[model samples]
Target: MEEKIHITDFLVIKNAELEIKQINVLIGPQANGKSVIAKLLYFFQGISTEFLKGIRSQLSKRELDKAIIDKFESYFPKYAWDGTGFSIVYTINDIQIEIHGQAKNKTKTKLSLKYSEELKKLYTAKKRIFLEKINDNQLEEEPLRGRGASEASIYRQHILVPLRTSKYSDFFSDPIFIPASRSFFANLQKNIFTFLSSNVDIDPFLTDFGSFYERAKALFKEDIFIRNSNDKQLIKNLYKAAEKVINGEYEYKDKQDWIISTKGKRTNLANASSGQQESLPMLIVLCVLPILKNPNLPKAQALTFIEEPEAHLFPSAQSLIVSIITELSSTFDLKFFITSHSPYILSALNNCILGSEVLGKNEKSTERFQQINNGSGAPLDFEKVSAYTIMDGKTINIIDSEYKMIGAEMLDEVSDHFQDVMNNLLNME
Candidate 1:
């Protein structure tokens, strides 16, 4: 979309539009539609990829238009698509993506995936499809027409992680998400242990991330057995990422029904401290991303969506998670969408942008700056990051990485007063 989303008559999105970014951080009070927006992006990205699965070997203007419209039915009728007073648009390449729906009697859903320059909708119809090539650019496009034919083929090779620990655990097989209630993952250790040590074909999304988590755990389980010379490098890389984040390597002890080894001590994943239970799997996943060079899956890219990775972590540890992701993203190809309420992470992200603005400069290399950025070895480029706040109906970018500054847009509204009160109490003058 235009890096901004506008909503009215929609849930909590009364009249707001947000700018989207590579490192999209959504922060706002509870029930303010932060998660809704994040999940929408996840869905849109999934459908877009699904819709683009078979490329038109022939990229003629008309050919491209026809091919895109043909898949329209694949994305319509989203589980939560029934609504009105809503409009979302984003332009990527030559295509403009738009979704419109309203709440009224027999509300209609209209989605526009229009080619801006051609002035032609993919499908045109009186009420159901957009099929005509129009001459005017000023005509506001309507949303999704009736529905395209449902094609099973359109849903293949798609990965969309929802914001639930168990629901999206399967995605963790590829290190995609780290949920807020990370500690809750322990309850699944028993099930996961069974899935790994047995020959069961279970649905991961059935109960949340199980498919992926079990499979990922199976890798660690296999690594212990397969220590083959061919795979040692990849194995080392995986654990190295783990060690970097946890300050200790990770190993699973088959004895006592799936225990994790950290710092030479063995403990059941369930028995690990709240911090360990919450942070361990997430840390391992972080470790898994950069080091996971040659995965068995055919997927070329990974999009990770973590909900409150700061859970149960100390301020320093939180920054470490941010830093490791930052370092790997600097080198490897990884996309992350995180939802958080932690200022530590917000400020750390701001510093990432700051470091980027003055990389290699004497000031940035100073010990103080380096310490502030201890989480990452590489300077973070804010241009690659987009921070937003949902306190308002719109998602607004707060960190102007280009200026090396953090805006008040995302700070706690009471933070200003808090600062003033603290300053007066301390008598800093």
Candidate 2:
């Protein structure tokens, strides 16, 4: 089954349906619901993580439902209502999950979530059998006496272990959402978690992203971040490309992030340029991906949602960042949902898709193409990519079928309008 998400009457988004792909990109003007779609996908794809935890803690169905509702509310504040309600249907593999809500008292939203019946049955059956064994004293009794860490461990062994390897596993891999406000966390450094704890009203998504960023940064405390031998060279190239994007190599020294420039000048993160601050957290995560491990879903493909990767970046730098991300995706077998408002980002991705086509035809042109792509191996299969423009409460495909590239018309719209204004001024003169 095709993976996709359909949203209707959701906040600023009147109606939008996106066909999810390996390299999904949404590009349009600001506040056109790009981030809304990204967050919805993040919330749904991450359901597996929460569901497993609910089962591990032996939560009743009613408790689990309330927990999920609360979690959803945390990601999306109650103020996003549009005087009505919304519906979201996210389909992945064999699962068709629906989230429908109704507005109440002009301030509250009542939500009802429906997922695959198989999952519900599985959860119930597992819980029942585990409880039966416990009642019969067929399992270890000491762990049950405390009902603490040991009991949780037993529950994991009985339920979570099988759930991880079951057919539902693919439906439940982690989705990392890197918000546009990521630089805020970078500026705070180690104090980010502390800040989040003190400020309880911050966006839950941003808070979670801050926590993930902290963990990613922690991976670099050791001498090496890449533990896989086969991927060492590829991961190293990723770091080199990332350095070019931020215009400096990142160093974790004295418990602070430092940027060491090519000219031998050193500046800590707080003192670095805004561009560096905006781009460093993302670059760090990309560079450290090789070492990041998930024991539960060890073989699942990683899904990442990045908002405005071009923030505070030069046009050329934006292109380089796109190349680095595309190359990293290809190298790590990861999938990305990226939101951007930059034409340069689209142009860069077009180059990647075209590079893949050109190199596939002529192996002899490898070195030349490498030079053009800045040695980032910036080649992406066009078939694996999907580009969309969200505007006027609608989603439109911006890829040109014949050219096998993102349509130049879409990327040149703003430039063309400005060019017309220039022509008019010249005529007046």
Give the best candidate by lDDT.
2
Which ten contiguous residues of candidate 2 have the minimum total lDDT?
220-229
What TM-scores do the predictions have? 0.63, 0.89
Candidate 1 lDDT by residue in tens digits, 51-156: 2322212144455444544443332333345444466654433445565554454445544454344223322211111112121212437523322221221212
Q: Candidate 2 lDDT, tens digit per residue, 300-396? A: 6647888999999998888878877777677666788999988888888898888888889886464576687767666889988888888788788
- Measured with C-alpha atoms, the lDDT of residue 283 in candidate 1 is 68
lDDT of each: 0.53, 0.78
Alpha-carbon RMSD, each predicted model = 12.0, 3.2
**Weakest 10 consecutive residues of candidate 1 by summed lDDT:** 126-135
Question: Could you say which candidate leads in TM-score?
Answer: 2
Residue-level lDDT for 44 in candidate 2: 86
Q: Residue 424 CA error for candidate 2 (Å)?
A: 2.3
lDDT of predicted model 2: 0.78
